[model samples]
Target: MVTTRQGVRLLGPGDVDAFLDLARRDPVANVFAMYRARTTRLEPRWLGGEAWGRFHDGELVAACHVGANLVPIESREEDARAFGERALARGRSVSTIVGPTEAVREFWRTVSDSWGRPRDLRWNQPHLVIDGPPTAAPDPGVRRTMRAELDELYPACVAMYTEEVGVSPEVGGRNDLYRTRVAQLVSRGWSFARFDAGRLVFKAEVACATDDAAQIQGVWVPPDRRGEGLAVAGMAAVVELVRAEIAPRVSLYVNEWNEPARRAYARVGFQETTTFSTIMF
Candidate 1:
């Protein structure tokens, strides 16, 4: 258990192993992986409280962060206290707080009254856990097809993501931060989608995965063709590929308020395992 103060140095691959240990208790490994990957890629100035943890006796017991998320640690409540202090000292105002729902709630409870509350958004995202037996493989079936030729897909994916998040996905070269994960997925046998109409309108991506799980992200249908519910079939195609190529567990994030998106996901066999929140002000 490393002491809380020593963890002031928590960033980069230093905390990778410990973080993975904590994620083991989590249903989806990708949730943690995506953020970790972002940390490595952006090297975002360690912007103070960039990462925080509370460990006891040389083991990480609790952790949190400020980045793609404000992940408050709950496995150890004391760490959350330490993390909040560190974040405030840095004069930080993060874009969002994304983490285990309850952990996030507790974090907010501490500062909401003082720093003022950000917009509260709940997630109804569902995760597909691997069942007792392996599922059947896709024939033409399941596959994660990375596009070497479709340079056009990036903008389209950005559009889809913006629509999904209700904010524009970064259009400037700024979002290149995600390219590493994109490339990582491609290298690790991840799948992205292309429509038969010859447009790169639909795709599936994973933020993180391992032998036991392969969490997914970036599922989208183009705005021009959304009414057709193309996202469902497209996601199904991706799910089959995930089932075949990646780990058995395939998961995705859906905004809690987005009923149509939730319905589409449930129709494809996803079930809500828990709630999560992404606080953005």
Candidate 2:
């Protein structure tokens, strides 16, 4: 462990236990890091990124995973500053920085000049979490997307991606890569869907799964299915299933401007836990 006079330490695969202990201090807020730490074992070479830690008097206070997704786990201004300086020193290698709103914004303030302006800044993201059974009745038909349903499910995944991110996953000729991810979700039983008369009606994926929580993503109700009470029931079903089978709690973050989503989640009993921000580079 190389510790700097400033207390910033670059963590490697060997530091998994310490990284995890730091992440567990607030499980829900640190779900992403906890998930990656457990699943990836802090491996030096993991999905094209690395993890770094900030220590204070030999105690790990914060950590950042920099890669395709630059995520910070409950970092303070000082911790964010150190991580930001490290990122700036590396040039613009990260694709995004996402975490608690304050930490992300503070970190961005430090690296914006070196990183250039972001293509998109989702600043008002409400992080919501739900525990126990849902209040609304779950959609009985909701179930995991089967391997055979990949062909039918792929388009819905694409639609959700394009709608949520303002650009198709197919952009930059990455359609094949996008399809593979959807397939992987289905194959791992991480995807859920409801079909009416053999047509896909609603879909969601457990994007991050930790022992304490499962964060849902790519939730979608087709354009024609809007205002039909599908989202509430469908989401209820997802929450019930995920809570019972995957994790003890379910969580997700939605853009604050998405009123309909906020309403739908509230109907399913999800309460705001925190605010997360994302800087898409």
Candidate 3:
């Protein structure tokens, strides 16, 4: 790890333990970073980008994951600024900047001028977590998606992505990559959904997981199925299964303005633990 002028250095295999220690400070909030580090072992060849560490007084205090997504782990304002500067030097390569609200905000402040306008800036996202059984009744009908169901599930995944992100996953010729990701999740038994007469009614996926926690993403109830309480019960089932087989804790973040989704998560027993921010390109 050669130190840079700003005390930020590219992390490698040698820094895995220290990086894990730093990220585990808040496992739910740091699950994405921890998952990446564990799977890639801090190797750039595997990471497809890099993990960066900020050292102070010869100790690793904070770190950032830079790849398709830029995520800061337990970074303070100054530390995030330094990471932002390092990213600026490397040019804008990530599709999104996301993390704890303050750190992401500070990181953006440092790079925004050079990075120019973002497609969207979500300044307030509630980071929620649940460590025990959900209060709502689990929907027994909801189960892990089978690999054979890929052709059936793919369209719903695309719909959810387009509705949530305001763009089709097929845009920019990424259909195959997105489809493969969905298939990978199914193969890992991380994708969950409920179907009625072979038609999908609700869906969600475990975006990442570590021993400590798992993060949920791409939650959706078809527009016609919304308000039918599918999400609440489906999430309850998801939480139950994830804790039983994947991790002890489950987490997810939602846009602050999305009140209905927030209410559904609350009904499923999720509690707000922190705030996150996302700047999407």
Candidate 4:
């Protein structure tokens, strides 16, 4: 039997170990890397401040992440229901329980049936892992350089996030939460940029990384720079730097509908491992 509660707390690292012991895992290479990262160092980022979790007989079994709806759970109907209730109580407003294929379907069928949100069971995401070597060579004219200071990096980072998500990075207009978030990421070493013709033209961030694998995210290029292989050059440079510093197994995520991005990742030598789904609400 599974018991769920609102604002539930667990001794993160220990409970995460319990949850990982509860079931079979995501087959995607990137998923495992991210999960391992979270279990070790990324826990504070996802579980800080009044988050949620599920337990069976006082043992942690599953959990729902607070800010980002990246629910990492072992499959169990009772556990799924309990976690869903806690998420709803926390105003998670989502219709997903992503696991392996069958588990994903069951989560959607049971948890969201009467919740009023239309469930999209087929929601899929493709993840790629960098293992041995890069598939495509860097563009000949492409150049890469890292910005040393947050002030030097903020403009490019902000522009890339805005362009990709179609929303501007939060700056002090009224409440400074959004602006502060961008600043926090840079302070934590999460930003990167590339330039051409003296113009800072491309940007991406290391969403999560360890000494071995760095997940590349928010890769964006202005429209005028598209098709010129700037992405190949810029991204290759990022991978090279990270690999030199840590591990060579780089990874990234892309939406299934994002064909252009899929192509770009392929050019960067990423082969998909598995699909994942997420709900914004």
Candidate models: Cα lDDT each: 0.60, 0.89, 0.95, 0.56
Positional deviation of 47 in candidate 4, in angstroms?
A: 3.4
Query: Where is model 2 more than 4 Å wrong at Cα?
Result: none
Give the local distance difference test score of model 4. 0.56
Better of 1 and 2 by lDDT: 2
Strongest candidate by lDDT? 3
Judge candidate 1 at residue 49 and give its lDDT: 31
lDDT of each residue in 126-215, candidate 2, tens digit only: 999998789899999999989889888999999998898888899899999999999988988899999998899999999988888899
Stretches off by above 4 angstroms in model 4 are 1-46, 50-61, 68-70, 74-79, 93-122, 139-153, 171-180, 183-189
Residue-wise C-alpha lDDT for candidate 4, range 63-147, written one tens digit per residue: 5443334454554556555555554555544423444343355445555544555434336777677776566665444333333
* Candidate 4 minimal-lDDT segment of 10 residues: 23-32
Off-target runs (Cα >4 Å) in candidate 3 are none
Clash totals, every prediction: 9, 0, 0, 3
- Estimate, for each residue in 1-281, the C-alpha lDDT of model 1 and write its tens digit: 23435354355556666665665667462355444534453244643335565666666676666665676644444455566666655654677777666666666666665666565466443434433232322224224555573365566666766766667656566577655545676666664776555566567777666666677777766667676756676666667766666667777666766777777776666767766666776
Order the candidate numbers by lDDT, best to worst.
3, 2, 1, 4
Model 2 worst lDDT run, 10 consecutive residues: 39-48
How do the predictions measure up, each by TM-score?
Answer: 0.75, 0.97, 0.99, 0.70
Better of 2 and 4 by lDDT: 2
The numbered model that scores best in TM-score is 3
Q: Candidate 2: which pairs clash?
A: none
lDDT comparing candidate 3 with the true structure: 0.95
Choose 1 or 4, whichever is better by lDDT: 1
> What RMSD, rounded to one decimal, does every model reach?
4.4, 1.1, 0.8, 5.1
lDDT of 1 at 68: 52
> Which pairs clash inside model 1?
1-56, 1-57, 1-58, 1-59, 2-58, 138-141, 138-142, 143-241, 144-191
